[model samples]
Target: MNLCELLQATDGVLLQGDARVSVQGLCYDSRAVTPGSLFVCLPGLHTDGHHYAAQAVAAGAVGLVCERPILGLPAELPVVQVTHSRRALAQLAIRLYDAPARRMTMIGITGTKGKTTTAHLIASVLRAAGHKVGVIGTNGVCWPGYRQPLDHTTPESSDLQRLLRQMADAGCDACVMEVSSLGLKMDRVTGILYDIGVFTNLSPDHIGPGEHASFAEYRAWKSVLFRRCRVGIVNADDPQTEAILTQHTCRVVTYGIDHPADWRADADLTLLRQSDFLGVQFTVTGPDGQARSYRLPMPGRFSVYNALATLAAAQVLDLSVAAAQTGLQKAAVEGRVEPVPLQAPFTVVLDYAHNEAAAENLLTSLRAYHPNQLWVVFGCGGGRSRVRRFGMGEACARLADFCIVTEDNSRGEPLPQILADIRTGMQRGNPRTPFVEIPDRRQALYYALDHAGPGDIVAVIGKGHETTLQRGNETLPFCERDILQKYMKARSS
Candidate 1:
């Protein structure tokens, strides 16, 4: 592709210097620059990409996409200036990938929770209905008849475009991606015009100095999905759903469990496997259509919403009720409310609940099942808000019968200080819940497993499906699920 053509797809930004520069590749990082490559200058949280502009040029960056005004450069090197680098990067990447997102039917799910589970259910149903569906979310990227390890929930703009192109080339007709607040705010999904956008729900998250400055900004970023989409599917029951939907210029579809809605939940919602591990069975009703029942392999109220949205999304995608039911029955997410295999007559769960809201939800659900005791093991990220850390500890102290404070990715922060902040939160609570602090995550797991009774339930939180634990600059190899499984098996034997 020529530099002239790429700039045309962008906001008509002037393409200075040679318009005939045949771009061979694209890069956002200066280290990856190569001959005839289009180097994008993105302003990051800690690093300004503009400083590396000369380095990119020195490394043979023939084309430059920058937000700042271009000054000194080879008179022949093509430079395009845009108001925003991230958006421009997405547009350019899409063009470079030949607009693969436009070629395929794309679905995006956003909100603070249930996005991963909803995406999983949708991908499963699509595959069962004999459609090639590609999935990109917290559980990792996969397509029908394919599975691939993913490092980021929402990858870099270039990686996103590259992956979409790969899926399209592999004959995938549709793709479902988890749209994060950060991803939308940063322009990761900029060029991809979504066919369907689903909002699961929202809560206080990613709100701090480096992330969203406030709740308003966070909500604003989630709204971007609805705007970018042509058809919006939202959980109408959520308190903020109307706000998100109103911002949409596209068509809207709503799903709920309480009443006869566009995608409604029928009567007789039961918690399947409630006595042992949790699961749910519910009937879905579409307007002027026969209701279909689904049996989810997972539990909780959120799972109900996840399946409801899946049914509606599947209906829109031309799938039968039977197909959606079958898919929901077998769909399982990796780290979101996952059940770890254990031989003990107790329940052991692995989840990515690292905050007060998620932890409260998980522990409260378990309490409803009347477990002998609920043990929660969680820790705060080193560089995140201390308010959240304290809040999560308070929630756990108020809810869980037993609490084990453990290390969770204390990158560049002192372990003792982080634990102290969590203790400060717990101190303000009932002050009766016993908490044993173990900086070693593995040691914490051993203590929790060794102490819990047969009827007790243990929840290992923070680092759900992730395989690494960060301590300052070092990322120790760790998988909470895998570690729990090994300990459980050893304890049983």
Candidate 2:
């Protein structure tokens, strides 16, 4: 592609140099600049990308896309100035990738919770329907033979476009991704039109400095997806659904258990627990009034909502109910009520319930299983709102039979302070609740497992699908599954 051709995709003004300069690639990070790469200077919170323009040029960046003028760069080097570099990056990426998102059926799921699970469910159904599907969400970007971890639930524009191109090239018929509020606000999904947009549910989350300014803003960002998509599939049971759809342009399709919707699950939902398998069975009546029973290998009423959302999407895509049944029965998301196989009589589950609402939902749902004792082992991440720590603590204390407080990503913050905040919330929630504080997460897990009684369900949460533990400035390799397997093996030996 040429600089002139790429500029046609954006309203960037060519400041200097030849517009005919060849652009082989595009990059936002200076450190990743290569020969013939077009470096896009994005303004960030910590540091301005404009400062690295010279470095990017030195590393063989053929042209520069920046928000401001550069003083000391080759006069002949191409420079395109844009009002918003982030949006420009997205535009350039789409052009460079030949708009791969348009080549496949794009389904985007958004909300405070259930986005990841719903995305995986939709992908599973698409796969069962004999379509090559690709999924991007909290777990990462994955298809049939490829899987990669991501730094954010929704990646930046350049990487996202590149990934979509890869998926399209690999013959994927559809692509489902988790769309984060921040990703929408940051214009990461710019220039990509979604075939179907899904709103699982919304709650107060990511509300703090450097995130959403307020809950209202967060909800507003979530609503933006409805405008960019052709068909909006939403949760009718959520009270905020109307508010989230304010100013929306797409036609709405809904699914829920409590309210009447295009897709409605029956009230007689069953919770199934047999040996190591935990699942839910429910019958849903769609818009056509045909009732069909579906079984998902995931428990809780929330899982039912996720299924409803999936079914609604499947119907919108004109897929068969048989495909939905096959997919739901086998679809499983990692770190989401994920069951660990153990020889012991007690059950151990790993979940990513790091917030108040999530913790409450998980513990309450597990209680229906009639565990002799429901235990939760969790910790709050550092450098985040103390409100989250307090809420999580309070929820666990109020819901669980026992609470084991431990360390989570204490990113440069003192572990003692985080633990103290949690203790305060625990005291407020239920002072009489038996609780113990273990600063070490691994030690906390061991303590819970070592003391587990027969028929007890222990939930180790907070660091769900993450493979690394962040402490201070160091990110250590940590896999909870590996640790649990090692402990089980050692105990058996």
Candidate 3:
């Protein structure tokens, strides 16, 4: 692509140099710059990208996409100035990747909870329907033969665009992704128009410094997806459904268990079974006035909502009801309410319920199983809100019979201090709840597992599906399930 054409594509003002230079590639990171690459200078929280413009130039960048003009760059070096470099980068990436998102059926799932699970469900259904599918979420990005981890729920725009292009080239007929509020707020998904957008549910989450300014901001950002998609699928049971639907320009579809919606599951048709492990059987009525029964291996009220939204998405995508049922039955997301097998009579489950709301939901749902004792083990990450730590502690203390406070990614924070904060919340919530402090996560797991009596359900929360544990600056290899499996094998021996 010519520099002049790329500049025109972004509507950027060419402040310096020749526009005739042919650009071979685009990169935002200076370290990744190659010959003939156009470097996009993005403004970040920790550091401004403009400082590295000269370095990018030195690394053989022929052109620059920046917010401000560079002073020391070669006079002949092409410099295109834009108002917002991040937005421009997203725009440029779409074009650079030949607008791959438009080539496939793009399905985006967004909300405070169940986004990842909903995405996986949708992908599974699409695959079952004979469509090659690609997925991008917190768990990571996956295609036919490629799987890679992501640092965020949504990758930066350039990377996201490249991945979408890869999926398209790999012959994927559909792509499902978890769209984060931060991704929308940051304009990472600015140019791509989704074929279908689904909202699982929302709550007050990710609110604090460096995340969302307030709940209003978070909700608004989450609602941005509806405006950019052809069809909007939402959970009608949520109280804020109307608020989320306000000013939405897309075609609307709703799904829920407790409320009237375009798609819904009647309470009489819903059944939850928990003889040993939990499972849910429900019949969902789609927009076409047809009921499709689904049996999910996982059990919970939220699981039903996830299934409902996925069914709605499948219907919107014009997939058959049988496909939705088969997909729901086969779909399983790792570390999401996943049960870890043990030879003991007591059952143990692992989940990514790191927040107060998620912890409450998981533990409460488990309580319905009538376990002899409901045990919860969880820890808050370091450098996050102490309020979150306290809230999680209070939730576990109030919901579980035994609460085990342990370390979870205490990056650069003292483990003892984080545990102390949790204890404070526990004391305030229910001083009578037995609290055990274990700084070592592996040791905490041993304690939780060793103490479980007959018919006990031990819930291990946080760090679900993640393979590494971050402590200080180190990301040590640690898969909670793998560690537990090894322990169970040794215990059985």
Candidate 4:
């Protein structure tokens, strides 16, 4: 494509360049620069890209995309300036890759919790409707025969474009992606325009120096999805919903269970359980003549919200009510309320509930099933908020019959110290019922399941679909499902 054409697609102003300048490739890192390559300068948490402009220039970068003012300039090197470097990179990558998002329907789901679940549900929803769908999120990107575990919620600009291009090549009709706050803030999703954007819910999370600076900043970054999409589908019951939606330029659609929302649910929100499985069942109705009954394998009232948001989002894409209904009913999300069959005695589930709110919610839902004894196996991540330990521990004590505390991604932090923090909260919530600290997660799960009676429920929390456990400089192989199934299979043998 011509240099002028590229700038037009990127919403970038060419400070100086010939329209006929041939483009070979695009890159952000200075090291990736070569002759005919355009280097995009993005400001990072640790360093400024403007500082590296000289290096990129020296590496034979013919063109540059930047938000910063050029310091020392050569007359021949062409530059394009934009309001934001990340957004510009996304747009440029999209144009360079031939606008793949426009050729395919795209769906984005954002929230503090339920993002992975919502994305999974939407992908299944689309596939059930006879569409070839691709999904990118917690379980990595998945298609029919090809599956690759993605390292980021949203990948780098070039990588994202490549994935979209591949999906387009593979004849996929739709793509569903999890839109993390980090992704939005960093402009990881710059180029693709979404057909529909779904907001599951929001809370105070991912807030720190390297992440969002404050709750207000987190909300602002999340708002970018609505601003960029054609339709903004949101949870009406969320306190942050109105504020998030009010600033969006796109058409708005809402779903909820708390109030009589546009897409509303029935009065009964029940958590149902059999010997080996537990889930939430509810009926939904909407002003747009929408009605369906769904029994999600996932638990908690949040599951209800996740489903409704998905349905409303499907509705925005002009899908039939029946198709959306079927999509959600058969939707399967890995790690979020993931099931593990145990014939030995009790029901066991593996979930990535690593936060206070999610832990409380999951435990509360399990409690509703009336298990003879609810056994929670949980732990905290290292280098995070130590305050969360108390909250998560207390939540399990209040809801679970007992808990087996263990390690979750303990990198450079002592497991004993982390266990001590959790014990502070557990002991404070209820000093009764046995609680043990077994630093190793696999062993802790064993202790819980081995002690469980026929009617007991064992929930292994944290490290859901993740295959590798981050332990200091080493990455340990850890698959919760594999560990759990092996143990259950041994008893059978």
Candidate 5:
């Protein structure tokens, strides 16, 4: 594309670039700069991209997209200055990628939790309805036969456009993605128009440095997705639903379990079982007066909401309810209350409940199975809020019959200190709750398993579906399910 055309998409001032220059590619990281590339200088939380402009130029970056005036680099280097480099990057990427999302039906799911599971449910429904679907979320950027791990729930805008272009090239009919508050706040999805925007639910999360400054700001950022989509499918049962929809420009469709909605799930037929697999079975009623029974292999009330939101989206797309039901019945999310098979007579589930709210929900869901004893092994991530440590501790102390506190990617924080903080919360919540301190997460699993009785429910929380443990600057391979399976085998033999 011509340099003028690209800069026009970003409303940027061409400080030095020739208007007729042909741009070959775009890059944010200086290390990825190639000949004739335009380097976008984003002001990140850790380091300023402006500092790397010199390196990008040295590596053959022909032009620069920046928020501030350039210095230190060659004065004659082509530069495009925008009010916000990140937003400009999104706009530039959309134009460069030929607006791939516009060519395909784009579904965006956002909230504090359930984004991944809900996205999976939507993809399943779409695929069952005979559409080739692409998914980008917490799990990864995935398509029919391809998947690559993602470092962010919503990737940077430039990468997001590139991914969408790849999906379009792969012949996908639709794309479903999880949009994070940080991504929305930073204008990562600023340019791509969404066909459907689904809001699962919201809670206090991602609040601190490098994230939202406050809950209000977080909520507002989440609402941004609604403005960018054609249809807004929201969880009507959520307390913040009204606030989120106050200024939404899209056509609204609501779904919920409590409040009356376009699509509502009735838990009257809901059944919780801890037999061979932990799961829930229920029925949903749509605005068309059609009711269908659905079973999700994944357990919990939250699963119902995820299913309902997905069904609602499917309904908006005019997909058959039968297809949605079939998709829901077969849907399974990894590390999301995932059942680990064992012949030890007790049930073991793996989940990624790292926060107080998620932990509380997970434990409460497990309690519905009426286990002989609900055992929980949980820990807080290192270098995060100490408040989260206390919160998770208090949640387990109040809900679980037995608690085993362990390590969870301590990063740079001392394991002992994190455990001590949890201890403080547990003491305040339930001083009499029997608990044990196990620093090694693998050993923590064994400790819980060794002490479990028949019909007991042991939940290994935090780091669900994660394959690595981060300590300081290094990340080592670590899978909770592998640890459990190996231990169970060794014990049986």
Candidate 6:
């Protein structure tokens, strides 16, 4: 592509050099620049990409897209100036990647929770219906034979476009991605129009410094997806549903258990707790008014909502109800109320509930199982709002039969201080609730498993599906599933 051709995709003014300079690639990181690459200077929270313009140039960046004037650059090098480099990068990437999202059905799922599980469910449904599907979200990007980890739920626009192009070239019929609030706010999904947009549920989250200024802003960003998609599938049961749908440009389809909607699960929901499975069985009535019984191998009413959303999307796509049943029945999401196979009398589940709303929802759902004892081992991440530590502590204290507080990616903060804040919340929630502090997460998991009684439901929350543990600027390999399997095997032996 020529420099002038790429500039046509962006609202950028060419400031220097030949418009016909050949462009082979695009980059944002100065360290990753290569020969004939166009480097985009993005303004960030921690540092400015403009400062590294010289570095990118030295690293073989042939042309530049920047928000401000960069001094001391080659007089002949191609330069384009844009008002917003992030948005410009998104537009340029879409053009360079051939607008791959337009070639296939695109599904974007957004919410405070359930985005990952819902995305996987929708992908499974698409596959069962004989459509090749690709999924991108918390679990990373994956298709039939490809998988890769991502640093963010919704990747940067450039990386996202490249991945979409790969999926399109690989013959995928549809793509389902988790459109995060930050992703929308940061213009990560800027140029892609979705075929279906889903809102699972919303709550107060991702609000603090370097994030949304308030809960209202966070909700508003989530609402942005509906405006960019052709159809909106939303959770009608949530009180914030109306607010989220405000200013939405798409046709609306709703799903809920307590409310009348296009898709709904009856009140006679069944909670399953077999020896090898823990899930919910419910009957859903679609827009056609045909009721079908479906069993999801995941627990809670929230899981039912996820299924409803998937079914609603399936209905819109004209997929068979049989496909919805088969796909949902076999779908399993890692770290989402995932049950570990154990020979012991007790059961252990893993989840990625790091904040107040998520923890409360998961724990409360488990409480409905009527376990002899509900044991929760969880902790808050470092450098986040102390309110989360307090909230998680309070929720666990009130809901769980026992609480085992532990470390969760302490990052650069001291473990003791984080634990202390949790203790404060625990005390506030229920001063009489008994609890123990285990600073090491590994030991914490060991303790929870070692002491669990028969018929007890032990939940290990936070850091679900994550492979590393961050502590004081160092990230160490850590897999909870491996730890649990090793311990259970040794104990059985």
Worst 10 residues of 2 by lDDT: 269-278
Error of 3 at 108 (Å): 0.6
In model 3, which residue pairs have backbone atoms overlapping below 3 Å? none
TM-score winner between candidates 1 and 3:
3
- lDDT for each residue of candidate 2 in 285-315, tens digit (9 for 90 to 100): 9999988889999988998999999999999
- Evaluated at residue 407, the lDDT of candidate 4 is 87
For residue 120, model 5's alpha carbon misses the true position, in angstroms, by 0.5
Q: TM-score of each candidate?
A: 0.95, 0.99, 0.97, 0.89, 0.97, 0.99
Q: How far is candidate 1 from the true structure (C-alpha RMSD, Å)?
A: 2.1
Clash number by candidate, in order: 1, 0, 0, 0, 1, 0
Q: Residue 124's C-alpha lDDT in candidate 5? A: 88
Root-mean-square deviation (CA) per prediction? 2.1, 1.0, 1.6, 3.1, 1.5, 0.9
Off by over 4 Å in 6: none
* Candidate 2 segments whose C-alpha is farther than 4 A from its true place: none
lDDT of 4 by residue, 18-109 (tens): 55677777888887788778788888878877778889889987778889669676767788888988888888788888878888899988
Q: What is candidate 6's lDDT per residue for 112-214, written digit by digit as tens?
A: 9999999999998888899999999999999989999999999999999999999999999899999999999999999889999999999888889988999
Candidate 5 has its poorest 10 consecutive residues by lDDT at 267-276
Candidate 6 matches the true fold with a TM-score of 0.99
lDDT of 6 at 238: 96
What tens digits encode model 3's per-residue C-alpha lDDT throughout 1-493?
A: 8878776667699898888998888898899999989999988877888999999999999999888877888888888999999999998888777889988999998988888888998898898899999999999999889999999899999899999999999999889999999999998899989999999888888898889999898999998899999999999899877778778999998889788899898775343544345668877787778776788877777888888888888888889878988898888888888888667788888889888888888888888778899998889999998989988999999999998888899999998899988988898888899878888899999998789998888899999889999998899999998898899789889
The lDDT per prediction is 0.84, 0.92, 0.87, 0.82, 0.88, 0.92
Model 5: number of backbone collisions: 1
